[model samples]
Target: MNLVSKNWEYLKIVTDIPKDYWSTKNEVVLEKENLKLRRFKNKSKSSNNAVLILPPQAGHSSNICDYAPDQSLVRLLLSYGLQVYATDWQSARLNQADLSIEDHINLTDDAVEKIREETGLDSITLIGQCQGGWQASVYTSLYQDKISKLVVAASPIDFYAERDFMNDYVDDYPMEFFEWLVKLGGGVMKGDFILKGFKSYDPYQHYIKKYQDLWKMILEDDKEGIERYKRFYNWYEYTQDLPGKFYLEVVEKIFKKNGMINPGTIVINNTSVDLSNITCPLFLLAGEKDNITPPRQCLEMANHVGTPKENIVQVTTKGGHIGTLTGSSALKKHWPKVVEFIENYSQTA
Candidate 1:
């Protein structure tokens, strides 16, 4: 191809990225206004232990848990002789913008109950990723009896654990600034705007460096590399809107107030969320290089949880935020160990 043709192809590839879809097959066992409970279809029946995965709800689809055939967390759990289910959070519309953190917790509780009913288990293991990690922590705290084990991957339990970029960003801005952004979105926080802020954290990588790499791939006619790029961007580019109320609450109660680690700081349905209430076997996963949620943010959970020191396990992967959950090396090396921890606990439960 000529230079002009190649340039056009590059522009078209970036501009018209393909839509994202879930690679794994799942059936929606339960549906609510804010989320759906999906049970993954797998042939393996090695164990009947049910696991509920809570994917990050920060303006992205829950499909991140089942990103692709090989990179899927759900599939990995299925392979380990465990039944897996996940929460698919819906993007907030104007009507849904009144939902709050308490509402999400309630919805999550409902999902958990549904899983219990289907599996006929009194409790199941809970796994939360990214934002979902903290959410899972809160749920486990409040509903401790319903959880056999808790695993949080790249989740921030203590926002003040480290002086990271996200803490700086939240601290530097006034509350009104974020409130105004939500106002502009008509009570919904636009996912595209959240994505922009994330990209801005590493502008060179998101803007110039990636395109430069893509141009080089085009010049070399690296079909495989280009295809890989397309698949990743398809998932990355799609955004989901969050309720303005929920966003503000996350900023104030979770981030600014550092509520998860502190008891009585976050209250839901008249019940205060106390991290120490979580007495189940706990597994905390952190990405060694994850700047978004620093390792300290995740590892600090060990200090606050009621789980005995011997029952708590922490693993740090050599990848970044999203990579910790879906990267090839993390999936191969770190996640299997996490699964093993869950399996060991499941056998006893």
Candidate 2:
């Protein structure tokens, strides 16, 4: 927090990973000017089938593979000899002020097509992590033929279930206050806004985590632990604002209106995306403790799919929101199972 400490703090944030931990030469693709695309591969020449990964909200290229550190899901996929490609969302700024849900869907579709062209593969599999799942669902509905198979992980589709934490927050919003934030931040959500939203669920939890980790860092003089803390802090403390229009639409459609699962009330580009439009084999992974997206919400999504209902598979992993992505279940159980499920299906398919 002091002069020397503060500058060192920034260095710690960027330096944790050793250079070798990252895969060499990720092929870059562009869905649009605003949406940056990159591919992570384990082999020089790869299979026709590759997993298109969409990271959780606020994630970037580093989320998929940390070359400096020997950890990440991309690493897991590479170890299995499978190819992985991920999307890197541009941070919100004044210029991207008019971005909407349609833009996301279109950009992703563009990315899919680009991947297909680059690999010369007629078909490709899809994996959506968290809100990325929502985007994937929309894209699949819009371009049903392009996607061969779909996997939605830790995703919430029901939108309006009373128990969902995010829905509840949206429902209680003072429209004026939320709108004020949009106007102030160029129609994007601030990182602090999301952090405060998370804190609302359990205010002291994050603080406690910092304190506990700080105590360990100080007592043991653990440079590695201290360094990791700084790196995560840079990401955690750095807030990216989201376009107001998209945020409003998300509230109007997915949260307040809860339109994704029910009626066609939530209009995207004058067309309603019925859940029935999803006819591809779908795999949904839900965290039993995920209040942000309770398991029931995702299950309802499977109910509306036009495909054989039996083709929809659900894996109930144990963890809360992000934990579902990175905790014991992710590192130990869920990630492995997820890879196997997708790989087996893609191979047999």
Candidate 3:
């Protein structure tokens, strides 16, 4: 096609992309003020095991867990015969701006109880991704008995494990600067503002390089590549506002204070979030190239958890932060092993 035709096609593809997407079919099993617990429909025979997925609450939709038919984490686990459920976190509105981190934790506990009640199992496997990972860790630490197995993928348990952009950015800025942004949003932290910080991590990639690649694809008439680009940005570009209190706590407790690594630093419901309380079989998944949460940030959990060294498993993939969770290679080569680990322990459940 001519240059004009290629440019028109590119514009059409970009404009036609949906605002959001979820590849798998699911129903809301439970809904709370802040989230909805969704249970995916599984066509295969179910197993004795059930797993709850906690998608990252970082300014984006929980649909990341079920990104697409070919790259969904939910579908992969379902293929392994385990029942799957995920927390669909809602964007914070003005009223929800006062919600705290403890609120989220309590909600997670309620979701866990609902899963147990439905499955008729005393304990179920819990898998948390990115921000959800630390939340899962705190919950497992508090209620170790509820979780038969725990997997924290690309989570930052030890915020000081590596000196990366996030750590530096939080350290360099005054707390007031962040607070001011939240104030501007009328109590909630606007998702677009948070997304700007993320994009600042690599402005060229988020701004220039992606568009350049799209243009190249348009020039080559690479329909498949254009489709992939459209799908990824449809999810990536969509943003979600967060409760001001919740956002501040995460920045202060988890990132600034390195709360998870330091026992009793983070407390919930009059209980301290001590990682040593988690004694179940633990699996830690990390991406070697993940600047957001480096491998050590995730792998270092083994040092703090009460689980025996023999019971702990750590797998490192070559992909970056988001890719580790949704990349095809990770889905094919690594996630199966994760599911197998859960299944092996499920025999005892």
Which portions of model 3 miss their true places by more than 4 Å? 1-7, 13-17, 346-349
Error of 2 at 180 (Å): 1.8
Over 179-213, each residue of candidate 1 has an lDDT whose tens digit, in order, gives 99999999999999999999999999999999999
TM-score of model 1 vs. true structure:
0.95
Error (Å) of candidate 3 at residue 53 is: 0.3
Which sequence of candidate numbers ranks them by TM-score, best first? 3, 1, 2
Model 3, residue pairs in steric clash: none
How many angstroms is residue 298 displaced in model 2 relative to the true structure, after the best TM-score fit? 2.4
Q: TM-scores of all models?
A: 0.95, 0.85, 0.96
lDDT of 2 by residue, 74-164 (tens): 6676667766788777666777777888877777878888888877767677888778877788778767778878888777687654376
Worst 10 residues of 3 by lDDT: 11-20
**What is residue 131's positional error in candidate 1, in angstroms?**
0.3
TM-score of 2: 0.85
